[model samples]
Target: MAIPKSAERSEVGAHQGSGEIRLVDVTKKFGGSYAVQNINLTIPHGSYCCLLGPSGCGKTTILRMIAGHETPSSGEIFIGDQMMIGKRPVERGTAMMFQSYALFPHLTVLDNVAFYLKMRGVGKEERRQKAEEMLQRVQLDHLKDRMPGQLSGGQQQRVALARSLITNPKVLLLEEPLSALDEFLRLKMRGELKSLQNELGITFVHVTHTQPEAIALADMVVVMDTGRIDQADTANVIFDRPKTPYVARFMGGQNVLTGTVESLSGGLARLRNADGATFEAATGALEAKAGSPMSIAVRRDRIKLRKRLADQVLSAVNEISGIVDSTEYQGSYIKVTVDLGGGVFVVNVSDSEYFVDAVVRGDLVTASWTTADVHTLSKVDMGAIDDPYLDATQ
Candidate 1:
């Protein structure tokens, strides 16, 4: 099943420019409702891109469109400069691994992986050899004789991945491929997917509602709401500097603060919330006038919390006084939820720091963060407008 060294090199060289995918103003409509609207995106050749959102957000629809299972109502899809509107799945140079890892129950693992080749009328010996090589590549060659029903979830997933990859596709589409696995297996398979994509040098568009999964596996994370993209950027940029409030809250690990701008000073804007609690944020080129609405995000890990003393006075600037609503111990850190009069704020206290002086429920506390930890949010409405400050972990 081993490929010759020169042949492998030639195959690797041919991967260039083959995996790039572009969608321009692509919209899908069922009756009067839009599944996806004016979607414009480009997945770089050989990069891992994640389409992340909640249920009914159209992530799976986008994946299907790219796989040729669903057609856009308008606009265009291009895979390496070739239009994909009328192309069949096989002709589009893409393969899909569904969330269920669709495999024939009657077929053995090796036969399941070789099914596509069989459809193409390949010689049985050649298809079997190629399927064995693929199974070996995915480290599942030892279980090739087992039926799909006999394999574990992770094993079945690998078999499915091998089946899709054996087609020598330029792009691979995954629809929540890890949702069926338990937490432990999910983590294990997440690493395998990324490693496999890197080794094969093919574009991977994975759809998932899990925030951590998307951030961990994607080079580019596209956050969608309803049917439109809220923000699309690198994982770090998306998490550290989200473009909109929906994205900031959806990505978690951030406490969003909303207010009205009271004044603008030297590179700083002062804002006052409905409760009259004032805060300051570095306005980095944002044009804001008095009375304009504003919102800023502060990372939960960046805020420091302390139990408020009976007689100690608190500073109004860069600090919030609240009662500890709850605390949950995560392995490395403690998630502390503080009840501000109108809303809740969260802070991630390192276990070491929490053990030094931990505060419990009903304890009066003060949470403080520096201006440098604050990031201004764009006013652009990308849906999910009801409560921007709603704690994502909840």
Candidate 2:
């Protein structure tokens, strides 16, 4: 059967306040293995949250359970004051915008947007007026008479958004909402989604596997690994101070370096690589035992490349010698990949800086950063943390 065109409707004032989502010890299991394991999260009322991970990392599973499409194997979900596990999705005060726009090909945009009200036994004139207001809100009123086949990808998406919002849901759930659009349309609609969410003053829980989409759209980003959350925090915290190696790597823009701790002195933990090149990072209050494996993340733009400083005295802290692996000329910045024996570092250089002293492949260079710039990362299970999106090509 085609997926249900409409969800059950709820009273408007019944869910007036911000839609706060609370998941308590939530788990979803398929057979003997868990698809989503013991997830406990609180999405603030009216906040924009993104569940970001690779395909099969359980982001969608969590979203489905929250939407009441699938019941959790264990634990409870609360949207506003209502327990959602046994309740119908509409009863939970949420409307989901599915990955596929799922618009009816035979219906005009007006009829499609009003289908939910129609199912609720609303008068034709009243529903049409309501749907018209929604279409105008999404800036698609001009296409109201067009069939789904007649509208563009962006237009169809607007129609979908209107249909979902017409329910007046307190929490709007989106599952891979932008995956259907082309690159240009996806970007344009991304901004619109955020703007709409703000204008409505409602919660938006978006599920996506794309990294940039999560970081750019979410006020709160929950980075997940296979069946587990690697990190969940505000966008700045998740991106700037990643809690684990997987987050640092998955979020992109940072280099993950692994080495054995050689010594600890003056609040700095010294780590040595395979070729004996060592670097120092601030240990803060965290315990660092000698010979234990430790990892650190340095932002791509934080690193500086130099021609070895051949004549000057040797360096202080956070410096490594490496051969230039390759250089990519990005419009605003150049990405220089350096091979440091056992690891690779990507240094992002401004366009002006790149043209001044462009280093090519095989050039001996020293990549240096600061102690304060380094962020320590907890060890992650390599088998679980490996990116499926990247693995597909390999």
Candidate 3:
């Protein structure tokens, strides 16, 4: 549906508060290829929304479209009720924070932030005062006189944010703003960024290639794939109940197995694996008809590993016997790979409990999990899957 155009533009003489933004059927094409396609999103005032995806997945394309760096091939952009088509980004009450931290090498931190304000004909005294205030907000007040090249990566990012926010934009479009930082600095900056967003109460639309970055900072997360949105929801919902196989696997390491329901009774179904093993799992939204093939998934950490004989474990439930194939140390935890006939299944345990030398590759092991941990998916109805954008290809 087409959004109604805004009745009138705000008069420059009047200072007005920011408004909500809506993008309807936004699409962008680069020659014959689509950079982004059929994107519909609403950024409510004072909300932090994140566009999350892997490389070449159209996240940056969507950000560019909103920032007016790339015009939509065909769509309507709305700022509150105002139509933003053919309008420059600066006129649309929005500002951009690029990944490169586009600060001038010769310009001091304070001057870099004050550059935009000065261009708007704001007085030098007011602009300097405002820049200092922004610098303080970012905890970079002491570095005001330092040049961009003289500051660290995190410090430079603070300068970029201070510059973008000095204009007090209604909508802030950030494209992988923390990508240039090291791992430790990225985590520190993530907290600072979230705090800054909440304090300002401005609409923030951030784009990031890293999953944890989006998951940590977003009020709403939009996962994109192949120029389309795979899912849009809260982090809790996306993580707990991913709608598709692709999404389930993308969120973390999940073990997906092909099987068919052999029997259903007492809120549980007996599934016969393609390799002829049988196990029981809890029922889910996609009901498995008898004899119909389906896919089952369980997170690696959710499965329990025990060094017991197969017969001693609870065989009626979702129990399987395997051999410990290998183990990898991951600092806080150890990833144990158990060979369950068809493929290697991974289980995560605390490093203190599961060790490299504790269990040998040839030792027999039994892996078991409850019905609540099992998620069922259907192969025939791919659309019925939870997270279609999850890149299982990875």
Candidate 4:
């Protein structure tokens, strides 16, 4: 199959910078339990790769191993051409920005940023000049003299950022760097961090549990589960064409309908659900013989809702009947919960016409989606896909 031009461009972007990092069969074991297991992944140079998983999924351990703060029990870590195994955190050309800004309360912003340069034994005047430039880069130069206590959460975050970048490390490791800020600041800083990475042309490996943050900042997303990489792909592929049941549910926003593949041909599959409801889906890469059981996922937003008695022309598509059990009025969308015997599905309507009052409890509604929007899963249920609180470390 011919690759699309956009896909080719994305591939090129993923390979930029020549500052490649590889984790070869890396594992960190603690007291007979594996925190990270046989994990092998290649992060392209200059790519913004996010290690995304729930707490204790070993993302932080992987970051620490790369930073030389923690050593891998079994595999090797390579940065560009350097082996980082026995090096100290400072020896490896890497910098870490933690969730806490960790700025000094007594030092001004300039002094905080210049502190690193001073440790390298640079002249005081040159170090201050470089610190001032970094402050300007983060748009915090105007607050240079203000102590850490005088700066807001967002401002202090910028100071930490400037401090880390002052030394021009080869790889910037950010471990929930924005997790400490408020919602508004976190959102704003996501953009700022992305811009900074692009401008510096440096390899950035950020670890976070927030799916939205990973989707917004990463050029490549590494989804980890049970101490191994479940899938590593661009944000679009990881979210849209997830390769596993764990990934489908972990990414959220999708309804996984398990069924048997009754027939397959011409890029389409006929699926019969456990509850005996049959649906059609476009199977692009999935291969299954007739009578084989599989699961299909469709995002709630992709499933269109129709009032049972409305006269609007119904488009020809797969459909399911359910009764509204609950409704929530979200400012931009109305979330209607429909109980479909075997499971419940939540669908969102962006049009204000379908307000919370549009479908009251016990109102029968039909949810529909085209074959192209349905995603096929080989073996998994909604329970495995939607349970974000599952112990990923195990």
Candidate 5:
């Protein structure tokens, strides 16, 4: 893919001399259980990285360790070339933006921002000037005299941001920073956060469980699952070519199909499940033979649904017959859920195309996808693909 011009531009207006981070053999254990297990990752200088996962998945533990609030039970962490095991947060050239905003309710915005400078023992006049400049950068200069209680949620967040950046830290660590905002404000801040990071040209390590949040802001996405990494790569690669079934299902928008390979010939392979239901798939880079287990995933949007007719059981190759259990109008497209007796699958059809589609609720339909859209899976339960949470969709 061609590089975008915005990405190729040189970084000339940036604070903080270094933003590189490296972690090697990092592990954290708590009461006979490991919160993080032997994690090794490197975030490039001047980049945006998001540690993405669900609750109790160790993403927050890793973030806290990076921010110097938690010490790792094992391994080394480096900010630039300096080891950060025993260092204080400020000493490590890093700053943290907490989820609560943690603004001082009693102090005015100017005082809240300049408090960091006060602790460093800077002159009052100079510190005030620096704080004023940071406030202007966040566009909160006019609210300098407002206390935290008097400011809006977004305004308070900007004040917190100004305080965090005044120290000129090499890297900024954000722990669920937007998780406290309302949905509308959360989305608005996402763009503001990304734009701020790009303008400053500093590394921002953000933690969040939201998939869309991770994909939108991250230059590098580190997806964690129960104390281990499922995949770590660019958002595009992780979304397009997931390496396992768990990643496929967790990342959303992919259907993980599993069965036994029945036969392989002429670069095509046949698969059959216990019910004798059959399908065809591509043999891409897989050395296949009869009776071998197979697991693959196809993008949800790639599937085409056709109304099933008597004696018509299959498409040209990969086909699945199911009952349309639900349909959701998603503005640009429609989400169609189909139940294949033992499993459930979802397909996204364009709104214009779906209005003319013959399949409807409770109707028998066959969902078909091409072999080219098939991607093999490695680690994860290949049992069935049924999402209980999806049953509650509005």
Candidate 6:
């Protein structure tokens, strides 16, 4: 895709610099309650960062602060080298694409995209030409004359993206931009957003509550909780080795287990749950003692499940005997939920392997995983145990 001339021209501006963002000890309070507390983050220049969490976790609040829509109660925000606390949105060199699109219903797509340039006193013909170039960049030039109400959801989304890009922003803040689209459109637009960010080479800070969306699109995924950040890392690291139980549960592909340490030997800790179920996990560098609480996580796909013999005893380590609570066919894999007495554990079996000897609900099953698959989790206050925004179907 050709770079927009406006973006090229804006590169010469004195404020233009590498689009790195820094939030130092930022906090926001609303009537004695904290919305975000002590948030310190640095998004690298030209990276796609996602602030991921459930509703009211302060992801959007952070985005608004970055866009200059909301001021931090304390601390400082910087884009490149410029302080953003008291600057206007334009002065911050940022543009926001709202969740609702927020396009003018009465304006044509061209006029809507050109609105930013118009506000800056650009001539009508010049702004129209620049807007047309941006529309073509987003592949919506043909729809330039159409009203916002006349466009489809996906088309309207492109228009909004075009409008944001037309500003030639150093950082683009997206507040659930795909939340309104249907599943199909959301998937399609995800690729477009990534590609556009790459072509533009600008920092993209997206706020979302969906785990898959964050994992799929982000170079760095910052998992937020109630007024605090829980984890921030690459998608692979966040998924494969979550730092805390809250993140493991929120990411939805790991089963978290809690037990008391029975013994520590050879860099491995043997733990026993209240039910006397034995589990083993790598101690790594963490200090462990007898009778101390320990938490471990195992990926759902790493578990092996098989029918249990009537008299067969389960293993003392890395194994659990449970009854199948439910099974969901997910095309490539089958999601099996097993009731492990006081708790439920989820296992993902390939469809081919699952069909060989499929176990239905109510079946007696023993699920086991290798010790290498177990990951020690930090003992922290698990935030928002139940996320109302989590999509059950996802």
User: For candidate 4, lDDT tens digit of each residue in 252-341?
Assistant: 667767777889889888888766678897777767778877777788778788667644443343777778998787787777889988
Off by over 4 Å in 1: 1-16, 310-314, 380-390
- For TM-score, candidate 1 versus 4, the one ahead is 1
Cα RMSD, each candidate: 3.0, 4.8, 6.8, 7.1, 4.4, 2.3
Per-candidate count of clashing residue pairs (backbone under 3 Å): 0, 0, 8, 1, 0, 0
Error of 6 at 281 (Å): 0.7
**Against the true structure, what is each candidate's TM-score?**
0.93, 0.91, 0.83, 0.86, 0.91, 0.95
In the range 1-394, model 1's lDDT, one tens digit per residue, is: 2223333421311233578999999999999999999999999998999999988999999999999999999999999999999899888889999999989999999999989889979899988888887788777889999999998998889899888878788999999999999999999999888887877778999999989999999999999989999999999999999878788889998888888899998989998877777889988867878898888999999999999987877657888888999999899999999999877889999999999998999999999888999999886333345653334553
Taking the tens digit of each residue's C-alpha lDDT, what string does model 2 give over 75-184?
99998777878998777889898888889999999999998889888899989988887787776778899999998877888899889888888899999999989999
The order by descending lDDT is 6, 1, 2, 5, 4, 3
Which structure is stronger by TM-score: 1 or 6? 6
Question: Model 3's lDDT to the true fold?
Answer: 0.76
lDDT of 5 by residue, 270-292 (tens): 88865566677777777777898
Best by TM-score: 6
Please give the lDDT score at residue 6 for candidate 4: 34
Highest lDDT scorer: 6
Where does candidate 5 stray beyond 4 Å?
A: 1-17, 265-269, 282-289, 380-394
Off by over 4 Å in 4: 1-17, 265-267, 282-284, 309-317, 352-357, 385-394
Name the better of 1 and 5 by lDDT: 1
Candidate 3 residue lDDT tens string, 125-203 = 8888778876876678899999999999888888898787776678889989888988898888888788767766778
TM-score (C-alpha) between model 6 and the true structure: 0.95
What is each predicted model's overall lDDT from 0 to 1?
0.87, 0.83, 0.76, 0.79, 0.82, 0.88
